[model samples]
Target: MRNANVMTASSEGALCSATRRIMLISPMPNRVRNLLAALTDHCFDVFSLHEWDDGMLDSLKPQLVIYDALPIASQPDAYNRWREQELQKASSRMNIPLLLLMPEEERQSLENKASVHVMRWPSEPEAALLEIKRIAERAQDVYDSRRAGESIVFKDLTIDPGKMIVTRGPEQIGLTKTEYDLLLHFITSDGSVQTREALLDIVWGQQFYAGSNVVDVHIKSLRKKLQDNAVSPRYIATVRGAGYRLADQ
Candidate 1:
């Protein structure tokens, strides 16, 4: 029952709203340290954990999980068996993808096991990151399909178009019609910068209003409703000189 050590790195200049987030977990501190060093400048939002934490999996809602299965010195066989069971449960229950890194010897034992995918452990850090990227992209495609018309999930925020609902964590945030429409535009163009003029045209259905800060005003109001700070936004970020884009988180 050791306390978990956690490290999270969300890279700057990364496509904030477009990339899939990943959670990395291992019991060995040295292994976790090495992997974090390798992923120093990677784009994806990575939340690394050493030791088990029950609340982490649900709270993060990561698109992918990378489990580095270094054998525990105390009880290698029993620990791995338990981990396999827990991972299988997480995969089926949450529909979250799981990638396991284990020794070649363990592969034979895991044959015909549940849906957990495995890669030989202790590969070069770059190679591991590359494989993780491939899996995450594939998983993201499936995630996108399931979320297509039902709702949009970005970090902790969920926007449901059908119900005209917007929530941050457990609380529902009310928005004006215009604010909701504007937010929807930002979600649809997740990775792209949307200029104020562009937003005005799309959201307001008008040409151009010279020197009018109508877009800015609405954006300010919208941020207030979403509990987002324009200066240091959690959802919508003001891209100086470029306009606005949703924060990747």
Candidate 2:
């Protein structure tokens, strides 16, 4: 007989292998047992904590954080305020979504925020699981759309295609048209080595002489502007026999 604890392919079809990481924060462990089990059954990798740790979010990197605030709702107003503030701080820094589970009566007490979703507590396990899945799926969609329109980040370097800007840490790096095109090509190549001939066609086009060393000249200028050391590069790296590729790190 298949163990009930084991997730089968049919059972995992909804969430599948691409399960989202969920951080569940609850003071009342007894009350959350059923919800935790349900989440596990649905293929969510849950990290449960009795209390909030400021560093947990950064370390665990959960896509969604569910804070069971029902226990805190009955506490002194001051204690509730402190808890909310801590949750806000952690969620804002990581820009992850927060799902606050509270009593229906306490709904009006909390203000709505883009990153925060509130759901009534003491719900049936299946109902809570459905709501949690809905919130998580919506959050993932928003994140995907935002990332599609956002800057490309590699290590400490950020490339904003929309603004046509590149920055290494706090300093902005300027590049000429050819240099910018070359750097952008390397980034989009997904760290794959680009041969000189390939890069010439992509960035310089076929109009330029095939034997010209213009690629090397512009790459040097780009490296200097971005403060990348070819010998020990932080951004771009040369593959010797091959051509250039973005740094893996």
Candidate 3:
């Protein structure tokens, strides 16, 4: 890792409650990097493995290692085989989460694997973020399961309408007030779609004229912390003629 990029320990101080050390294994795949960048204001320590030294197996520990969607190769068997080798021993931190972004078709083959969580790539971004949150939650469960030697399950991520906290699984996703309210509206619509207008109405409280794109900005912010894909999905379906919905997966 480059010293210029890594913050000094004194500057880092204690990890903020909302902050985490995330090590991403792939290049900014599927616009997911934008989402990670979105988290900068919230105190995230995001590092792409491409930026790490070969000694990652021994140093530069992180709370999670995300393996994002890559361009599909002509040979998937050879691809996955080679992929496995990279992950097999690189992460010595056993508790760290491994979030794998994949196509819906390829997801099943890796479903039974231990410690790896998969989200279908190529869905609209709305669905991707929901799935990312779901995956983060799942990773937390896996961590807990190993620690306590028990199985675990989670419902759609829980957002406290009153407390402003979003609990994805074992971890509480940190959210700014605006981002939290936006998600609350998305989840509370009973799976119904909400238009940009509706989102503006709910989130900004009373609409004004003019194309603000404010909704788009906030959505971008939400997507990063959730580690969502802009193209594929598991929740938050985009209704081209309508708006966005928490779709049934």
Best by lDDT: 2
Note the Cα lDDT for every prediction shown: 0.69, 0.70, 0.55
Q: Model 3 Cα displacement at 215 (Å)?
A: 51
List candidate 2 stretches off by more than 4 Å: 1-16, 72-78, 111-115, 144-249
Return the lDDT, model 2, position 37.
82
In candidate 1, position 215 carries an lDDT of 83
Candidate 2 Cα deviation (angstroms), residue 39? 0.5
lDDT of 2 by residue, 1-249 (tens): 111132323354564656777888877776788888888888887888887876776787777888887755467687677776765454334446577787888754553322356777788889988878876775675466446867767778787876778888888887787888788666654354555765676677657676636778888899998888999998888777646777876
lDDT (tens digit, per residue) of candidate 3 on 6-50: 322323455555544566665434356554544333354666654
Enumerate clash totals for all models, in the order shown: 1, 0, 9
The positional error of residue 72 in candidate 3, measured at the CA in angstroms, is 4.5
Off by over 4 Å in 1: 1-18, 150-249
Residues 1-249, candidate 1, lDDT per residue (tens digit)? 333333244456444444456777877757666666655456566677775455888887888887887688799889978786666455434446577778888865653243456777777877888877777775675467447756777777788877888898889988989898888766654234565655665677655565438888989999888778877788788777657776765
Clashing pairs for model 1 are 16-248
User: Against the true structure, what is each candidate's TM-score?
Assistant: 0.51, 0.51, 0.41
